[model samples]
Target chain A: MQYIHPKAIKVWRIHGMISAAISFVLFLVLMLLGLFLFRWLLYLAAGFLVIGLVDFLIFVSVIPILRWRFFRYRINETHVVIRDGIWFVKHTVIPMARIQFVEAEQGPLLRAYRLAKLKISTATSTHHIPALSIGQAQKLRDRLAAFIQASDVDV
Target chain B: MKRAHPLSIFAGFFKELKQLLLPIIIGALFGIRHDDGMSEWFALFGIGICLFFAVIEWWRTRYQVLEDQLYVKIGTIFMKERFIRFERIQSLHLSTNPFLKLFGLVRLEVHTAGGEDKAEFALPAVKRDEALRLQERIGGSNRSSQEDLLAVLDRSENSERVYRLRGGELVLAALTSSGARVIFLGLFTLLGQIGELWDRVSFITPLRREFHRVIGVPLLEAAAGVAAVLLIFWLLSSAIAFVKMYRFTLTVREKDWVIRRGFFEQTEQIVPFKRVQAVKIRENWLKQSFGYASVYLDVAGGQAGDGASEVLLYPLIRKERVAEFLAAIRSPFPWAVPTAAVSIRAFYWKIIKYVVPLAVLATILSLWVPYGAWSWLLVAASMALSWLGYRDASFAVDGDRVALGRREFSKETILTERKRLQFLSCRVSPVQKRLKLMTVQSGLIAGNNGYSFRICDLPLAEGRRLYEWYITAYTRSARRELQRVDGESSYSL
Candidate 1:
């Protein structure tokens, strides 16, 4: 069993920064409206600013580090086991023989971090491994693909 | 390779035209209202392209069976050849639309393993005899699954009919089914074309005035509206059921079980015995009281929209006759009878889970509005149902098979073989963990997606045992055979 790439923490923080940027823009617009249009709306602007700061401290800084510690996955000969989530935890085990395909994809954020997301699909469900180094993700995909090809079709 | 009947060229044309209908309709509408000269030409151009593709597609598409492989070559621009080995082929279905039937042609859809949202492909226009011959040739890949199939045929080679939904039973099944949804769909469609339908049914205007006069009270008006919807729903439900389930017959033969159903555009689905993943028996309160239940078979392959869903074994059958139906499909299952009342914790948890929240809401309503105290009756009803739910829900493991029975608004019983399970999962939320409870859930590939059987609020130890029971062999095998994932892979992700 292994935790995801530590770079995932940085990615989460980058994601949080983008969200903070959007909220800052919202704050500016709301404050302007409060000053010019509706005088009482300054209270809403103040509340939103406090929420954004608290969110950055607790969620952006603290939760990502906790998340990196909790998220773990292990792939074996017969099954893939995933133990994930800090809040709403889940443990999923998908049979190796039942997997239809293994795919690797990268979003702009993941691409910048040189990381990729692996999607392991069965006949019914798709399970995700959030972030892995690009080369490692491809290696896992190939190894899983070969394993799937060698295994009997149970689905 | 052989070409489809020439008439399919016309079918192809119409198929293309059907896809382009929205644009054509829009064009026609524009032509009629705005006197746009381009609108008529646009529709005509679209029709011309449709006709061209129809001819090209029909001409280029050819299919054949040779050396135990069903091969199809399609595409007009860049030819693509596809083949399915007889062993890999999952199910064989034959269908005929009225237009194709006019030329004595049937469409054969060959489904194989790997769930992609449809039958692997369809040979649009083959003869009925040809389709049957193709089905006969695909004897299925697995020999272990065939011995029982052979025995079934040996017992009754000449007699193919297992069960047929007779007219009365058909009507009863339809009546019991919730057809109100179909009528609601119809009402939305009618509302979509209100201007055209509203003008023709001018009688409704006078009837509305009469209703306004007689049921002047708001509550009575709502009551009348509901009664009318129910009346229309009953009529529409029966009609749809009659049309859909007309001459619905389940027949079996050597390799595959064939279900021939539908009044118009008749469909015949041939499912290989090995494809069956599990058996599900569902009984609502009314059906249970009547000693009747519906049996559904969960098959492994084919897309959901391809009408390859949980194939209905029997729409309605007497509970006593279930064993007879089961015997036809596969070996007789050990029907599990629950032993005792539900656990005290789960029974009480059901109170906290359902009744408590509902009771609080009811109390609020009772304190506020006029006659709102009636909400307490609903709270009482919810508590009763929850009790019934846990009391009836039980699971049993007998040898290599497991039978789970759960009762919600309906009683659902699922019987699954150990080998057929894709994966077994145990969900334990934080609250459930504190309560020392977990949910045991298992999945099997069926229809477009799959079917999952879940039983909740089991003791943590019990759930762990079940999870271990499912994966113990695999886990041991995994450790012995593979230690492939090693070292840096652990630290990387």
Candidate 2:
């Protein structure tokens, strides 16, 4: 098993923070609405404020480290095996012969970090590996494509 | 080169009118609101335009049957032509309702694969004989050898009838089908109506009094009402099933299988062996108790039936005779080995997984809602089903065939060949890791786009073995000779 690029932790923190920010902003709007427009929203908004604060603290300080520590993946001649997910720890095995397509994607954030996400698709399911070094991702893409003979693929 | 039957003119006119109906209605309404006497003429003009287009289209559209393909030409100007190779044609469907039947006409549709609700080619109206001739011509390309035809015909065609619905089983199948929701709803409605019936008919005179006197007890009255409703639904559903599957017969000749059935609207479906992806044997709770199951096939090509994905093969059969039926049809997939069972500990896990959340919901409902105490019944039901799931769910690998037996409200047995499977996977969580348990899943391309079979709560080593078995080609054939489907077996038809 191989760990993802260490920069993934940074990506994870930013991703988490962006979501947490949305909730915190929603809390602020709810508080403002409760103060001016509706009476019942005051208690709900106060509860949301506490939730938003806890979410901010957890995403920035706790989740990214745990996610990075747990994520592992492996690619071999016959199958691509991945062990992921925070709580349930889903393990997936996709046979190379069944792979329909392989793709690599990079957003502006990932581009800044020189990282990419590798997506592997089978006839019925899709799997993704987030935040791999771009060179490594490209090498993997090419190798998997080369190994998957057109004659071997089946729907 | 030829044009469709003359009735196509009417079909085209109706089709064009349907598409243009809304605009014409709106236009006529505008005229009427303004108190214009010309609205009638405008409507007539719209109809005339539709008729004119229909005539032009019918006259221009022509089809030329070639040696091995069908070429269709459409439109006078800006003409578009399409060539559909006979070899690529997957299935032929011919159908007619009462109106078409009165005119001895049927709608013919030729199909291949991939598109939804769109056939490769369609002739909206054609004489029944011509449609049959075209079907024979196009379908013959699959097994075209004259010698093969002679060989199949030389033997008895009746012997080729692999399976047919018996009179009793046809009714039995309808009775046990998944109309359970309707049954509960009907029962509740009938119960609600009993009080209303007593109140309304209390003063309606002798008929109500006479009926009440004959039945006497209110309990008996309720029971009779329930029985009457059940009987009516049973007969109604059975009548529907009978109309569709009357005299259902599956006949095999070489590698192709043909299904012919129906009472009022006859249907024929031809499925080539290579197109079958998997076979499913479904036994719902009711059917399981009755020792009956229905067999369905996941066919890959052709928009075959009422646009349904799974094709009904055997609508009803004794669960034990499924193997015999498969053998009779010479199916590539044969049921053989008994599937292994998950451990008792898996039941505990299943109960925890399903019942815990349901129990919490039930508690909250009981605390807050007036009638929420009944929610505990749901929890009890979930617990029982989970136990059944643990007792039944498992997987097996024999030669090139893999079998998955699972229970989720119903027990379904999915059997498929290795070459048809898209992929395989195994998964585990932290709890499963401690318990040394895993779930195995496999995918196959089906008419429903795709279907994945999941076998939950297998021993960790067993799940790994099933996963490894899919990728390991060398070991697959080691026990090939021992496969049950290998030897030719004879059974009473």
Candidate 3:
């Protein structure tokens, strides 16, 4: 098993911060609306603001580090195994013969960090290995395509 | 290379009419209710458009049987052409409805191994002899004569009556089946439509009032009426099942297996042995005790009644004779072997996973309802069911066949050939990891829908063995076949 790209922590942190900022803006709007609508809602707005701060602190500061540490994947001749998730950890094994295709994608943020995501698609489900170096993603894609071609023969 | 039967124009008209039936009926109803001439004109315009398109479609559609493939050119404007290789055709069927029969024509339906709905190419109306010839060509091309001859010789000398379900047996099968429950639900929806019509029609109001007055207690009478209607519907559904599966017979011919069944609509499904994906034996609670089970063939893209994926090999038979029946069918998949039952710890795990949370939710829900204690019976029943399910679950991987027996008021033993499986995987939940258990999920290509089977809470060692068995056995067979072909020096024209 290999861990995802180290820059995943920073990527996840930025994602979490962006969502947290949106929540904070929503909270500020709610507080301002409460001032015009009702007095009790003002206290509710204050409570929401406090909850948002705590949520942001945990999501941006704590979860990304844990997730980056835990996410791992392995590719073998016959199957691809992915292990991830925080509380109820999920382990998925997709047979190589079943994979329809493999794709490498890069969002603007990921491209900025020289990272790409590898998606392995099968008939039933698709599994993704997030935050891998572009070179590794391309190699993985080629290897998987070769595996599929080799497996499809004679069966 | 030829055009479809000339009468296909009418077939196309009827096909289009079936799609527009509901809208046309609604349009007519609105026209009548509003006393408006506009709706009638709109409907006339719609019908004209449908007829014009149907004729154009009939004119545009053309099918040709090339040396290696079936080519279809359809669509007047787009002019789309599709070529289906003979090797990829899983099933070729010739069917006739009353309209087609009047013109001595049959619809030739070609289904491919690709289970997409659009994968089917139907030549709406073709001469019966031409369709039969095409069926022979496709079936013959799917497997060479030499290989089929070898397999046919391996069986018993008699290629006579393979299996036939008795009328009593068919009736028993229908009586015990739970399929009528779905039919009953469908009927309820249909009745709801009628109820809406009853509400809308003013003439029925007085009749309803009179009926309620005569019934004394209207509510209880209505409930009784519903119960009576349901009983009648159930009987009707059973009769339909009987008609649909009447004289269900499997005959082993020289070249392929022939399945003949149906009462109102006699259907003959000819399946080449090579195209079969799996053989499944199912036993309901009653049937299990009676030692009777039903057998179905998972032929890739085989179209059965209502577009179902499997063709019934035998509607009902003694479980003890399943091995004999399978052998008679010359199915490549081996007979099932009873494997170890699911782990006992899984009993507790299932209880925790399903029962506990459901019980909590039910209890909280009962608080809002007037009579909540009755919900405890449901919780108890569910817990007992899960325990029974855990106790009954079993799996085995023997040679080329992987058999999974699961219980849900019945036992379904699925025996799939390793070569036919689309995907296989084993997973472990955190709780299962602690308990040294795993669940294996496997998918098979069967029709347009996703067909998957799962075996939960097996010992980790057994799960690993199953995985390795699949990988090694599948690859070894592939390599051996390749080597055999290479060694044969396949020099062909």
Kindly report the docking quality category of candidate 3: acceptable
Clashes of each: 3, 0, 0
Question: What digit string (tens of lDDT, one per residue) describes model 3 on residues B397-449?
Answer: 76666787776656778887665566666777889888887777777655444
As for candidate 1, its clashing pairs are: A3-B493, A4-B493, B304-B448
C-alpha lDDT (0 to 100) for residue B107 of candidate 1: 72
Per-model RMSD to reference: 8.2, 8.4, 6.6
- Write the residue-wise lDDT of candidate 1 on A31-146 in tens digits: 99999999888888887787778668766899879989998999877778888877666677877767778999999999999999999986667789999999999999998988
Candidate 1 lDDT over B9-78, as tens digits, reads: 7777776776776455433432243356765686688788888887888889888878878788988899
Q: Please report the candidate that would top DockQ against the real structure.
A: 2
lDDT of 3 at A131: 86
**TM-scores of all models?**
0.71, 0.75, 0.74
**Lowest summed lDDT over 10 consecutive residues: which window, candidate 3 chain B?**
B484-493
Give the DockQ of candidate 1: 0.30
Would you give me the overall lDDT of model 1? Answer: 0.69
| lDDT of each residue in B57-152, candidate 2, tens digit only | 778778988989999988745678988888766556666655677898877776665566467667768887787677667768854222223322
Candidate 1: deviation at residue B303, Å?
6.7
Write down the worst ten-residue block by lDDT for model 2 chain B: B484-493
Steric clash pairs (candidate 3) = none
